[model samples]
Target: MEREIFPWIGASRGTSILISKKKSFHYTDVIANNSSRYIIVSGIPQHRKITLINIYAPNSGQLVGDPILLGGDMNLVNNPLLDRSSRPLPADAALSTALDELQRLLRVTDVW
Candidate 1:
């Protein structure tokens, strides 16, 4: 698939837009869009439409709604020792807690 850009105007740090696509990922109808900080989409599969949300969430992940695929650059680490670029840094308790909550919220494998 190729990128499509259209006339867009003022919005916040994140925005959601919708586009209709003929087919994608086993779905005959797909709708998707991206913003400065997130991407959101819905696909009609098996006669039902489900959503996937991609975000650059702030500290808390800010998860809402039930989504089939929830994705983002959450800046969280399941294993701090291995996730950093170089030397490991100490984990922030709050971020860890938030990430844990996000994990529980999604209830799925967190691998990319």
Candidate 2:
């Protein structure tokens, strides 16, 4: 059941945006009543490629930055409740931490 539903959902979301193991890629473009964004992922067989994500973060506005990325709609800006570890945290803590780290990282031009 999970396998069956997975493919259907993937297809519905236009996840087949690329092909080839040597240079495969996929992206989703979403447009809502007042917002738009993109999610992209690409790779090669033995090398790390690009994963460009565009998301609307609250208050801080549009943030355009580097390759090899993970981003999403962080609903709050300048919140300090997030954890800074490599491992996952509880949902609420993770959200706050992720936003904090993203904001902090964005400030450092050399880090991106």
Candidate 3:
């Protein structure tokens, strides 16, 4: 599996890749820096290609359309603790915003 790392916001990142198997498939990993919100999208090769997305949202949402799976993480888990005592701490909101933007871009791109 070949991988490519595409950085969006500072420290917050996302990855896009092409996995070679019996058929070629595309994948994207969107990760936030401070939050536990990580979204993944996988595309299967077929006449009617299937797109599967694994999302961790700390809120409610719905899945729309075929070959698309939408989910949320209503409860916050796996999120690192904030260090207010430190010189500076990254904001979770920023990271969450970045991940959201990345997801939108990946969904529209043909490379996915």
Best TM-score among the predictions, by candidate number: 1
**Candidate order (TM-score):** 1, 2, 3
| lDDT assessment of candidate 3 | 0.42
Over 4 Å off in model 1, which ranges?
Answer: 1-67, 91-93
Give the Cα lDDT of each candidate.
0.54, 0.38, 0.42
How many clashes does the backbone of model 1 have?
0
Residue 53 in candidate 2, Cα distance off native in Å: 3.1
**Tens-digit lDDT track of model 3 for 42-109:** 44455445544333433334534435445544222122244233333355556645555766876732
Listed in order, each prediction's TM-score against the native is 0.35, 0.26, 0.23
Please give the range of 10 consecutive residues that has the lowest summed lDDT in model 1. 1-10
Q: For every model in order, what is the number of clashing pairs?
A: 0, 2, 1
Q: Write the per-residue lDDT of candidate 1 for residues 79-108, one digit (tens) a residue.
A: 565666766555655676778787888686
The residue-level lDDT of candidate 3 at 62 comes to 50
Worst ten-residue run, lDDT, model 2?
1-10
For model 2, the superposed segments whose C-alpha errors exceed 4 Å read 1-72, 76-90, 108-112
lDDT of 1: 0.54
- Residue-wise C-alpha lDDT for candidate 2, range 1-112, written one tens digit per residue: 1111012123323222234445433323323222222334333333545444334333333344533355344444333333333444346566666666866877622222
The predictions' CA RMSDs to the true structure, in order, are 14.3, 12.8, 16.5
